[model samples]
Target: MNIEIIEIPKIEDYRGNIAVIENDVVPFEIKRVYYLFDVPSNAKRGGHAHKELFQLLLPLSGSFDVVLHDGENQQKITLNKPDKGLLIKPKTWRELDNFSSGAVCLVISSDVFKEEDYIRDFNEFLEYIR
Candidate 1:
């Protein structure tokens, strides 16, 4: 699995800052958008892999860690900045953990919600990769 950290363009002013993201900024066009917030410290999310969906994750508020596996390799990444994002491709198993207080995770997906597209079982994911 290859994960890319993207630095989005940000405009800063006296009042606040703004980050702009369009279709051309990522490898896949955004088709769905969601966010996770007010999560408990010990809670975890995302324990699955997609067959075709691609995703970009941004830490809009606080911080969290994303653990990725490709059946052969595993990696953990920390997301803490609003201007940065992690681009996740298909066939990579992912787990989100170690969320800080008041953390907000913004996710941009390449496809709409489809239950069949998700590989939720780790054993099934390994078989699919082979």
Candidate 2:
């Protein structure tokens, strides 16, 4: 349950606002950046946990829900702000769903893609955390 909600710095102007994410804003050194977009209303994403990866999920557009578990406790959160992000530490389970239309989720990770680092099974994730 070490999950954190990060507030990205926003620069405001008469025309528009800009949200900035610098290296100092995040706890880890980001090595990858990805996003999920155009997901169907009923479609779901992310039902796994990483062994060592740290991720920050930001709602760039629309809204979505994220469920996080630490093998003993669970929490659910709604992401609807472009200037806020959810930080997920390693060895924690995550599931995402309830996506609104045109929802865009931005993900910043601590490492590149590696299949062996994912724990796709809930039971396995719980066992590994123990």
User: How high is each candidate's TM-score?
Assistant: 0.96, 0.98
Task: For candidate 2, write residues 18-126 as lDDT tens digits.
Answer: 9999998999998999999999989889999999999999999999999999999999999999999999999989999999999999999999999999999999998
Clashing pairs in 2: none
Kindly report the root-mean-square deviation of model 2 from the true structure over all alpha carbons: 0.7
lDDT of 1 by residue, 1-130 (tens): 6689999999999899989998778778778999999999899999999999999999999999999999999999999999999999899999999999999999999999999999999999999999
- Model-by-model lDDT, in order? 0.94, 0.95
Please give the distance, in angstroms, between residue 111's alpha carbon in candidate 1 and its true position after superposition. Answer: 0.7
Q: Which one is best on TM-score? A: 2
